[model samples]
Target chain A: AQSVTQLDSQVPVFEEAPVELRCNYSSSVSVYLFWYVQYPNQGLQLLLKYLSGSTLVKGINGFEAEFNKSQTSFHLRKPSVHISDTAEYFCAVSPRAGAGTALIFGKGTTLSVSS
Target chain B: DTGVTQSPTHLIKTRGQQVTLRCSPISGHKSVSWYQQVLGQGPQFIFQYYEKEERGRGNFPDRFSARQFPNYSSELNVNALLLGDSALYLCASGPGNKDTEAFFGQGTRLTVV
Candidate 1:
């Protein structure tokens, strides 16, 4: 079984400020990582994913995450953020070998941006 | 193109009653998955179906049952519902390929009283 932990339950930042949402996972084998964003009353949208290869994986909306194998972390970051970026962020992990496996998600981190 | 769509955006049911939720996957998608999202918590996997066959299920009880149709539509039925079952039911559709991305629907909010 695999689980994901999001260190921050909520993050508040001013517009144009940089932000980092921390995530960690515990797995015995290789895993695929994903970051999903959920706006108010909406379904989740994929922000980025880390399947393999380069440590730094960039995603849509200027978001990026670095897969740190040693630390077991896949933290999401953005150099500068807009108010539109305010939403709930979830971290998820799926087993690499387990085909048809369901993604395990973290509780989530609420990102609130104020102008 | 249409994304995943779940019907009955909001539903209210009494304890011990039964409820059924529906989902229509995107065109060409072959895999449909169901999840429950309790307030203040992330969604939990419930079941997955591919090609109209059960493929995977999470640590849920038998009271939660689901089936997929040949057209890739799906229905999730909950028998003997409990108040604890109150949550948002989400449906997701994927290409059923290892490399394709999975898309989610807005979800059906179920309130059990």
Candidate 2:
């Protein structure tokens, strides 16, 4: 089984400032990592995913995440923020060897960006 | 080119009643998965169907059931609805592979009163 933990429940940042959302996971087997963002009253949108190869992966909306195997962490980062970036961010994992690709998600972090 | 689409953007039901939510996957996708997201919480897996077969199930009770049609569309049914059943029901679709990313729908908001 795999589980994700988002360290912060809420993160506040001013517009154009950098922000980071921390995520950690524990899994007995190798797994896939993902970051998703949800706007108000909407479903999740894939920000990025770490499948293999590059540890530093870039995603939409100028967001990126680094996969650290040694730390069992995948933290999301954005160099500059906008008010529109305020939303609920979630970290998720899925077993690479499992037949069902059900995603196990963390509680989520609310990113509130203010101008 | 259509993304995953779910029906009845919002619903209200009384306790002990039954509710059914629908989803249509992207073209050529064969797998559909259901998830429940309570307010301020991440989505929890409910079920997954591939090629009309039940591929995976979460820890939800038997009152929560789902099925996929031959065309790859799916429906999620919840019986004996409770206040806890009121949530945002999300449907995601992928190509039935581990390497691919799943696309999500707009989601159906269920309000059990």
What TM-score, computed on C-alpha atoms, does each candidate reach?
0.97, 0.98
Which prediction has the highest DockQ against the true structure? 2
Second chain TM-score for model 2: 0.97
Q: Write the per-residue lDDT of candidate 2 for residues B5-92, one digit (tens) a residue.
A: 9999999999999999999999999999999999989999999998899989999999999999999999999999999999999999
Off by over 4 Å in 1: B97-100
Residues B45-101, candidate 1: write the lDDT tens digits. 999888888878899999999998889999999999999999999988999733237
**Cα lDDT for residue A13, model 2?**
99
Off by over 4 Å in 2: none
Looking at candidate 1, what is the lDDT of residue A111?
98
Which candidate comes out best when scored by TM-score? 2
- For candidate 1, give the lDDT of residue B21: 99
- A1-115 per-residue lDDT for model 1 (tens digits): 8999999999999999999999999998789999999998888899999887999999999999999999999999999999999999999998888657688899999999999
| Docking outcome class, model 1 | medium
- All candidates' lDDT scores? 0.92, 0.94
In angstroms, how far off is A32's CA in candidate 2?
0.3
